[model samples]
Target chain A: MIEITEVKQYPFIEGKNLTLCAPNKDNLNLYASWDNHPDARKYARNVFPTTAGDLKKYLERGQERAPREIGFEIWHKADCKPIGFIGFNFVNWADRMGNIGLNIGDPSYWKKDLGMEATYLILEYAFNELNLFKITADMYEMNTPSWKICEKVGMKRELTYMKQAYVKGNYVDTYQYCLFKEDWEKQRQKFEFK
Target chain B: MSEEKEEKKELVCIPFIEGENVALAPTNIDHIQLYAKWNNDPRARHYARNMIPHTTEDLKKWFEPRGGLTEHVGFEIWHKKDKVPIGTCGFGRINWIDRNANIYMNIGEPEYWNKNLGTEASHLLIDYGFKELNFFKIYAGVFEPNIRSWSVAEKDGFILEGIEEKAIYVDGKYVGARRYRLFKEDWLNRKAKK
Candidate 1:
């Protein structure tokens, strides 16, 4: 006879290979590892060192719904583990717009198209479910892969700020990508999204 | 009448920055009703793009200090002569590492509009951001139809950074939002020339 345990995940939005779920405190250790990882932190815009205690506090606060921010944890359907995070950070309800943020924490999952799928899922939820008019994303010019994922999701490069951000002792340009709901509605059909 | 008097007695204005015509003061929790009035007033809230109705309970949460490093700093606009709070203004979404923040203001009292108070407030707040707060830059966004706001931004020497197309929805139509930026170096140079 054998005993087995299951990882409980509360999936809020399901995707092809991934699902966005409510962040669980049981995964704090995994979240801490990702927050401290150099490559992940660079693209995630974590300027200061993040502690486990900080992550705990964040999880505790996440229990309540915040008016301006809505976040979710990305659970890899096949792997049975949380691999990333994605959400709308600045939701302007009156203007019907939001700023999107996504972080693929697991290094093993990088460049696997999981992030791209997650982006599409979130966009559908934003426009179709939430009725957001516009969605915007910002990224460092050096982070080509991140911006590429945004472009594949029908986002356009709206503006470039010269030397707007300082990262690792060097100033870098920041790019803002925007997509309107009406335009996404027209393009989502091409992605086979009903 | 007695209850109103009790509420008036609780109102306290603590000036943080003083200008000739208006002084920047910490927001008084006792004046949540007044702020709610301004937030819901049709004529006053039109240019501010406040579409949602705000209740006193909703505003109390906003006024409550979220302890620790705050990303926002709001102040009540106090008229010197009349000794009354006419509106509110401050910096929101402050990026400490990047040394930048978004500045916004609303003259809630319609009678106070076009009195150069906004110009005075902008000058005082901009000076405080650069000199006292050691901020590198400040950003502002004005809806395309808001000529008065852009005029004040221009008078304060803010340069047009970019225009976000069809970003805001108003009156069943979409409108662009004009972005303006002011750098500390440019402000200093302008002052030297003056």
Candidate 2:
């Protein structure tokens, strides 16, 4: 729970509805709350309790791998508060490829198409600014919202692994979606129209 | 006197993986000077793409414990017959959550070049990634001009995944990089056939 008075933003990629900002260390408490919140924790697979200490270490590790990994805090412009996270989990510079990850931890913000807009913004940054040739995202089969956002952002289902993850007492399938720069360029028009 | 001094220097290699030609040992901090030399070697650094000088202090940071699951795991390549270190190789840019890692190798000793040690080392490292680390995919990137490394990847059952045109700046000009990948299932099938 970041104190509302202490909420500060550092916009790295601005979107129509949201801004992908540099991850704020001060928001660790809020991140931990999301990890424990029932609505947000299930899809994120935070079965185990997460403490602010854990998130602080994660943020530090993310910074240590800055060259190969980039992370962002998704900020809601109207609310002036953090809503989610989106960034490349890892980038292969030699191959110009990266794996993206996104989580709208605030359930109140779900179903608003904020995720899709954030995806489009990150895709544009990944291809144009990062000069990445390919971007990939993966999710559990149960995580429909996440994959749907990936699909809407021009990623195509590339691979499916049967029973890849155990969730809620049963194994579930996992899917990988990929978008090449050339393919995304063709599909960018549709997002631009939005 | 030089030979006596060299003999007096303690060998601190702990073999982590053994092969027919060479053994992979946990990178020794005492060998930081050796690692630094390899990074600055003319022939090795050409393919290694180390334009800036790397001091022993810079190399020592790599050997320090970073307190959690490490994204990069480097190993010293030791010649079995000669009982001396020849080069370095291992996994880097590991995506543990996705179970994928990038495999890289550099035979620092120019005298050790032309031998099939790279091929042997790649096989051992890839096996470690797939079997021990439970990695789903292993990747290798080779510069367009480094045909030897390309052949090594080809011989190690890695498939040509893609090529990034002019992706890396090397030797004062840009060059393409060939991305190679091997899946754990495919590797297991090959092992079964063998």
Candidate 3:
């Protein structure tokens, strides 16, 4: 339901000491390699390696899906390299809600608060640009670092299921977290990007 | 004897108990006013079974054995900013056989509703249930009219298990009750992906 052609490039979002921007064609290789990272794959729905050609095809398909799903590779404006990917997928226009999934592909970017900054950038896109009312996300319970990012961005944990998913021949529990547009608006008012 | 002591020390170091920013301690008679406020809320009354007006005796009866096997353990949700109690959250109808439990939460002060306090408190309680109490699943039975609560549950990762037909009698009318649940394993899986 999203008008993909209408999707404009998101300018840099200034944080306390960082800026998040949309990745360009030049960084596609970096984005693909980040996606293929085993550590990043651990929490991702897709586990297979992503080739540059695959990345191009994927983005082409994304454009066809239009406003319903959008992907953006996150980059620090200062460095200009892709650090992660953040996006809204399975957007339901009728309900004004969407499933949000993101990953900080580069381990070097971990724990530096870049994830939080990227999250805020995407949230702005979801609520301000896309007019979404609710955004939901799921994470493995043991992935404390990612959950910490969720927490920092004000996503609230709503439920936890035990051993509900079988991954890599082992069962694990999943946690669902969400943030409402209103809540984000309120938080944005008080949030210091720094 | 020395070997046994070493085993005990190792177990203690395992960090079986998980703590959260929101602490849910056992309630006392001193919390009577807080309980009364929650019980009087129209929305709370709409979901709760009709009972006699809350009295001092009722408070004592409720406070007694909150930590007991059969009774509900109530906790006053406190503000992390000032440590001032503002709401209530806890578990009831603990089913050991099914390894499940019922959860309820209320921010008596309307101002705090949707302010992330409930979500934070709920997350803390959920971690307690999954990590400390070892509950396999956590569930909530909510009135159909409470869309906000439903959103909260959905955000927390609770899946809609079922809807009971006219399961609750509130304000002289029969109301439908929607059940939401989160399994421990599923929660872990979702968390791991994040």
Candidate 4:
């Protein structure tokens, strides 16, 4: 069994103007609010509207898991406001791999390259602290904007299955992308973390 | 303005077979070392279908047959402005069956990996494939781990065919392979779209 722990405190991972940190109950409302956004629901697995109570229960369950996947709330370090969430899920220790998912729930932050910065920080934690060998991510083929983030951050598209999953009564293809530890190291060197 | 005009020269149409910026010409004995370095690079090897390290002798033997092909061709990918050979891109494994061939390239110099040189060279090669070689289709195989290659293929308008599982073994693991093809008809369509 893989032991999971909350990163209770973290130094601000500054990249451009964005910072990332572990989510607390105070930010649970932000998660709830983002969960209710229509655009967020379009690609999210659990599309149903979420409340603060639901988020609390979700985080609690996450904490109870053997291989605890942590979610971190993204912030603008300069302004100290919640922007979105970025973290790992479905972590498998034996394989030393995990799924990385992120969303900039705030439209104000979209297309500002904040997603790339937030992802770079989370990947640093996954590769450096967690010692994960590979990290995988997925997005619907039509979600070009999200996949562009994958491209900008050096994640490679590994697979695209036709009619792989049914979403909202329509069968849609999802592009599976991945970044290995070595590749991540190369990207780390290129990422401007200031 | 007159001073700037004095520095400019007419662009020369160099032979496609003479690769520009590369260190060793395609048929040179030293090319074995070049191939070894490219295959050993984690990023390059990832898309190379998990190629194992090749001894100098192994590389020599591999190139022996390829170098003998009447159409055995290679070109150095140069920095357009500086004209430094950062990589090599060209055809290998020319098969007459179905009138197709494999396209290969290596930006052994890591600094140029994300730059658009590979794409530009590939476009030039595809044009050569159609107008010069008179080929019906051109194909290439990339490992599932190499996402940059897929993006390049997509940008080049190559159609994804299918996956070949456990097709390659390297570093004690079986890596899956992806096949992509660009047909003459599709190429024409793409050209029209452009």
Candidate 5:
């Protein structure tokens, strides 16, 4: 006799080919690997390697939500693996606002619309489920893909922290973008993707 | 007996600098509610980066024991005519190393806005920054959406430094930020000319 069991796919919030779920212990190695990758590190602010021990601590931090913070793992529906990360490191529940941070660990997933889709999914979750008022994302000026993805997903540029970040070798400016729930609602309608 | 107590309350609200309509006073614990109320007001909070909703308790953490937490001392603005607190303004912080600081201001009462109180208070703060604290450089980062704010900074002789593109999120939009700086030498020269 043969037994058959269906494979389970976990997705807290569903997007087309992307699903956002909580970071899992099983994917700790992937997080560490991505944070340490040379190509990935160039875009990411993490100068130090995310070792297994450090990642375990980081995973634990995700569990503690307070005045407001949420973490997510970007799961590729087709590949069934978390190819990226996204989170609100600064969440003001009372103010209905948060500052979002994201990174795609797998370089191959870059420019595949995965980041854009994940952002749309999170924006929906942030405003509808969480009842947030506004969401913001800030990136180094050199991180063109980041700001572009944010702009494509309805975030409008709002602020420039001049020479704020020390990146690679010299000081670089950081661009900040944001969208309100109502604005996102209007903008999301204009974006239809496969 | 009640009248005497009321008089004492009025006495405590006295201003440090008596402007034409508004006067500046060192912020006191009793003024926490006023600060919290204004900060909670979306219109004023939007420009000041007071995104998080502030409760009286939160205000206490910031305004109370104002002596210890930081060098970012605040002042209460009292409307001379109404004898009521109109807003708060002061140095955001002092960089002892750099001999400079950022200017802070907020007109909680929407009615009080554009009444030239900001300009008057800015003049006062700039005087304090240059003459009192001996700061070499006093600067402010005005959000691009806030034209009136930058205009006042300009009127006070704060030169346009450099713009950081997309620096802050407010009113459902990402707004660029302009840095304005005023050197003590310029202020001294202007004073000498006068």
Candidate 6:
């Protein structure tokens, strides 16, 4: 077993209830356990079982990142635990645009508005710190929590692709949501970030 | 279209997958003015989501090469007989992991409207996507009133999948947007028969 207290803490973006920190590589087993759960894995498109070795490889690949894709663990301030994760993917620094993927692994933490908090925290980091112009999100049609979180974060429905992804032995539509820096500036207040 | 620029365009040595009347040419950054004209034209932009005027700098950033899953690429539709650039057609936002992409195209000059250039360009793009890119499915979005767009998609063997109501704010009011898809199996079948 990996040492928990020995794991280095990299606190980066902090929100009212959630803190976005660097992904802890030492906790690959913990992350894999969450990912292997069917409820959470469904939205993430994990048809195959995810092992800790796979996660270790993923962390190794992410370690060579040029800020193109950044992953973060969502630390709940009240619980003082990493209940979920969020990240930027396929980021084009020149274009100042990217797509984001996020998940709250613990089902017990569902519908708590912590995902919304994490989103605002990440948006601030993406638009203001990274100087990105836009951030997009994609979710299968049946994953209401994901697209709903996108809507709650003031993201506009960019496109609805018909039968774009296969999930649970069925073809499903995919929903794309986009939030521009300018639009975020205007709608940021709605998120009620304090 | 200046005399010097026209001469340059004529002498330009951008190779293409040549067709009978139209060739899919590279989108050279030097011809930003040509692309900007198409992007800014109300007739063309009417059906597109591009609301802002495009500049050379934006085009340069857009032409930057991107790899992996979420890349956007466009091809210039070069009219061989007229020896002029007619339009642009190519993949918009691509989900490479899912093996699907959005096929977007437009004929720049209004004069080329009824010449079947759009249909020809669509066919070329669809073929390139299925054969070259190995995409499993390709799709296009058409506004509610744009029957011409839907017809072109049909001619290229696309089927209407679904429609999103009030999906777009076109001229004044919100409008429904139609979605169309062409599967690789169907495309390959057509090619084999031909």
TM-score for candidate 1, please give it: 0.86
TM-score of chain B of each: 0.94, 0.94, 0.79, 0.73, 0.87, 0.90
Ranking by lDDT: 1, 2, 6, 5, 4, 3
TM-score sort, best first: 1, 2, 6, 5, 4, 3
lDDT of 6 by residue, B62-131 (tens): 7665665447877888888877787888898787667788898888888989878888888878888998
Q: Judged by lDDT, which candidate is best?
A: 1
> Model 5 segments beyond 4 Å from truth?
A1-10, A25-67, A78-80, A89-99, A106-112, A124-136, A154-171, A177-194, B1-56, B63-87, B90-103, B107-151, B157-194
Q: Model 2's lDDT to the true fold?
A: 0.83
TM-score against native, each model: 0.86, 0.70, 0.48, 0.48, 0.57, 0.63
What lDDT score is found at residue B138 in candidate 5?
78
Specify the highest-DockQ model's number: 1
Indicate whether candidate 1 or candidate 6 has the larger TM-score: 1
What are the per-residue Cα lDDT tens digits for candidate 6 across A13-64? 8788888888888778778877888788878977679899998887887454
Q: Is 2 or 5 the stronger prediction by TM-score?
A: 2
Residue-wise lDDT of candidate 4 within A1-194, one digit each (tens)?
Answer: 11114333344555668777667675666677787878765676654568889889876774554465768778777655777888886786645678888988877778888887888888888899889888888888887888998898888887775544456777576787888888888657887776
> Which parts of model 2 are misplaced by more than 4 Å?
A1-15, A19-27, A36-49, A56-72, A77-81, A88-100, A122-194, B1-18, B49-51, B69-72, B93-101, B126-145, B160-189
**Span of ten consecutive residues with least summed lDDT in model 6 chain B:** B6-15
| Candidate with more favorable, higher lDDT: 4 or 6 | 6
Residue ranges of candidate 3 with Cα displaced over 4 Å: A1-20, A62-66, B1-194
Q: Which ten residues in a row have the lowest lDDT in candidate 1 chain A?
A: A1-10
Query: If both were scored by DockQ, which would come out higher, candidate 1 or candidate 2?
Result: 1
Clashing pairs in 6: none
Backbone clash pairs for candidate 2 read: A1-A29
The Cα local distance difference test for each model comes to 0.86, 0.83, 0.69, 0.70, 0.77, 0.80
Ranking, DockQ, top scorer first? 1, 6, 2, 5, 3, 4
lDDT of 2 at A48: 79
lDDT digits (tens) for residues A1-194 of candidate 2? 45656768888887887898998888998888877888888877676799989989888874453378788898999888998888887887765778898888888899999989888988999999989887888788989999998877768776665544567777576777888899888868887422
